[model samples]
Target chain A: MSTLQGAGVHGAASWRITRILSLRWIVWGAAAIFFLNLLGVIAVVIANSFATHWFGSWLPAGWTLKYYAQSWQNYQLSGILVVTLQVAFAAVIVSLLIGTPAAYALARRNFPGKRLMMLAFLLPIMVPPITYGIPLATLLYKLHLGGTLTGVVIANLVPPVPFVILVMTPFIEQIDPRIEAAARMCGAKTWQVFLRVLAPLLVPGLLAAALLVLIQTVALFELTFLVSGPGSQTLVVALYYAVFASGIRPAQAISAMAVIYMLTTLVVLVVTLRYVRPTQMVGTVR
Target chain B: MTLSETPVASEAIAGPERRSLRHRLADRGVDRLLLLSLPASLFVLVFFIYPSIYGVVLSFRPLKPVGAFGNYTHFFGDPFLRGSIVNTFRIALPAAIFNVLAAIPLAVVMRGAVKGQRIINTILVIPISLGTVLVADGLLNYLGPNGWFNRVLMAAGLIGHPLQLLHNQWGVMLSLVITGFPFAFLLTLSYISGIDPKMESAAATLGAGPWRQFWHVTLPLLVPGLAITFCLSFVLAFSVFPSATMLGNPNGDSHVLAVAAANTAFQQYDFPMASTISVIAAAIELLVIGAVLGLRSRFYAGTTTGKG
Candidate 1:
């Protein structure tokens, strides 16, 4: 196929074939451009975070570590990081607690209204958070639960619970039902069966789901932004406020905060990637 | 055997006489396991479904306690408020389209064996974890008039002046494309890779060229997945909030509906009005999703893979 047939193919046909093959080059070129820009977006932040000063130049004038320190103090990042971790871990625990059971039931049982129940789990994942987040925030505020860690945790729980259910449902299904039946036949109660048989088998799936939820909660901006108060701001929200606030914060400080946020989520994401397929994060709906 | 048989015999005996709901459900292959889903169902009911319904209800009640449709009227009557829908579409439609379009060729290329596939995927997925806020922050620095993008272009003598990439509609669009592309790409990759490769080989044996094979064998099987991908991406882009604010002129060209809704709720302290805009935004989003999915049904849904 690579060699153009000289005997039968005319000039136009050969040229067309050559052009089509060159499409590969075109594809690679576009991809390269995309990756370059993406890297630039990330690299520029890391660069500016450590730069002493930067203006109309290719690189920062000089590099220093002071902005990271300054941003740590100026943003009260220690408190913000604690809140972020609290919200993330809380979301993971609460979501796993509820979602894993639903996933098990959905996987093992085919009751009436099963489709509707699955749809209920799916709606939160399918809908963008901002649409539901506004009302969710309003509801939380009306209940006087807004502007607190509990509110932030509850708001973040909306997506991951469904996420866990969807993700773990398949994982649960992949486990042999005969194993469960054998455990049940051995005189183990339902909870005992879950504890002894399912839990051990489900640890990997659970850890992956929990880590995904942790990464999502850390990266999740809209829901937390809507419900969180001044003190309840996660790292993402705090970075947003630092950037959005009126004061002319040096670009270095904001970039430093962004780098910190990036590191936190990326660290969790790296762990998540270890257990879960990257495609699973987005394609769980299918 | 009798011990197991005895339970079944007793259930059979108990099935007809004074059957309670629990017995009825158990007879139909449901039992306490089904009940396990109740907590999650209740949680979703209270937080997700209920809030959505409440928001719709609240939209009808404005802050001033006027007529039922006060907030809706207020939203539609104000030109600035109403124009945000148009502005949002202006940003969202293009971002979604570009993301899906750019994703398709790359997805097709990456579906087969590629070198450093894991590393490539890791790099691609990084922006996702970085989130939009960081992406916007990064864009402001990298694509700002004085930043490296313009600097590099200047050094190459590409233009006389640094282009206005940020603080405009273009900046928001750029950020959306950067963030939205990975999502579209991953979804499309999964969909495309799910297709059987032998279909293309089959087409090739019939004297079809690469383009012919893709057009006839691949694309027909891919349309439905693409439609869904487009819908999902469109929904995500339609709700552009943080990036639109940070990268673009929020009050001017980039005044998306989300920004308007957020501003109403937070800045103006009008929760009802915010709910009104949120409802409208959701309605519009659902309409698009429905229309796309509806169109997808027109395509052949026999099987996703070409094996069938």
Candidate 2:
């Protein structure tokens, strides 16, 4: 009996050890993949920027900052960055200005066809970008707005406005309505109540929404590619043309620019996540 | 008698007039709010609603303005275009299956009490925010014939020549997997975490092993999440454009509905035909989403808990 008990104890101990090892293995494996994917892209871009020719080798044969130096000397990199920043900033501001009021209206008031309006706003997100890109571009061209930065910004607004509204509505809903009512009772006007009472409470949500919209606008490809002209091409669209239509050298330069854009976006997203949780924005969707 | 009657009549008239003025002011306040929504409302109507309706109408019209129903007829009659529709379903369905299948094990492994979960989560989510262009670019550099994979294979003496991965359907598939898997995995992980651990432990105590417990208890509970994840990932992969264009040969066998529509509208300037294809794509997407919603309602018919 004692021998049988001893065998059982040994088996249990082995099982426990295996379980622990497996769990540890899984954790480390996930961590390794995460680092490889995230850091790997950065490493490739950095390596390509320096190497004259690194094909067929695990590591580059040589390294220099010549590509970065060349990109700056030509002014292509700075020009694209300026345009990207301008378009993304304008798009985010417009989306926020338009979306906040709609979000407030949806959250605060009981209006007719509220559900229908909500669906209308979300429709842009549901349909594919390709479906709208052509028609929107055609329509913009007809209006003489096509091939302009404003045109690309307008096209981008469709997604960002709805996204902001979706994110901000919950934030607005969490603010105590009674505070607004009390403000009214104290003789504050409707606008005053919104400005003084509610806006402060929604500061985090607003920042989060703005950052999200900005990131999305900067990363957006299809609509911008379809609508943007030579003068208005965003960095992403520019990079795309450089890679596909142009030669490898320009593609490398563009990739270097893309790395900068991606890194900036990552920084913004991390900051946003730290300050404003997605759950706070999208958690109450139900 | 006349003077007294005049004074009373004037007072009565002023009282009614004052009440009507207040009503008008209240009405004006409501009207102003409605007016404030006008700009946004008009924007949506012109940009979103009109384009969508135009797409639907264009689908019915011929590419050459022959007549209504011509373009759709052409789409249906041409075996090549018709084959694209089938190809779309083939790609989207398998991608959804593969993504969901991969998500389960990845989520299961990640859910174990482990350190660095946050870092892993961040890594998984990074691809999602990286957008399709970057993902495609990375895959191109890594998986292309002259890229890392082939180089490694050649060095290892596994193959005499480089393998062709880019400019093929599999290239698009790999791009989709890399981009799509993170979304499915995250959704499944969040869902699985919400499930009470006691149920699994109870199954374990009842002599069921981990695999069996997962297959019976955990999998059943995960159905709602699986359905939603499948639909979401399928919708995303189905409407793929940048990846399809950059990674695959759109003019060749890889032309799906979105690519075909883009070609018609942009390349040919045939808006009607393009619109028609988009409308059809939208309808198919709606039907799939609707079916998933129906399944969700059926599955949760008697349950009180909400499934994300």
Measured against the native two-chain assembly using Cα atoms, what DockQ does each of the candidate structures obtain, in the order listed? 0.75, 0.38
lDDT for each residue of candidate 2 in B138-208, tens digit (9 for 90 to 100) = 77677767666677679899999998888878778877877787777778777787788887888889887
Q: Which residue pairs in candidate 1 collide? A: none
Over B1-308, each residue of candidate 1 has an lDDT whose tens digit, in order, gives: 88889999988988776568767778776887777888899999999999999999989888797799888887889999999999999999999999999998888888878887667777788888789999999998899888878888898999889899988999999999998998999899999988889989998998888888888788888888899899999999999999999999999989999999999999988988999999999999999998888878876565444546
Q: State the lDDT of candidate 1 residue by residue for A166-244, as single tens digits.
A: 9899999999999989998988998898899989999999998898888888899999999999889999988888889
Backbone clashes, candidate 1? 0
Which ten-residue region of model 2 chain A has the weakest summed lDDT? A277-286
- lDDT by residue for model 2 (A53-164), tens: 6766787787666777665555376777788888888888888888888787677665557778888887776666776777777788888888888888888887887788
**Clash pairs (backbone) in predicted model 2:** B59-B276
Single out the weakest 10-residue window by summed lDDT for candidate 1 chain A. A1-10
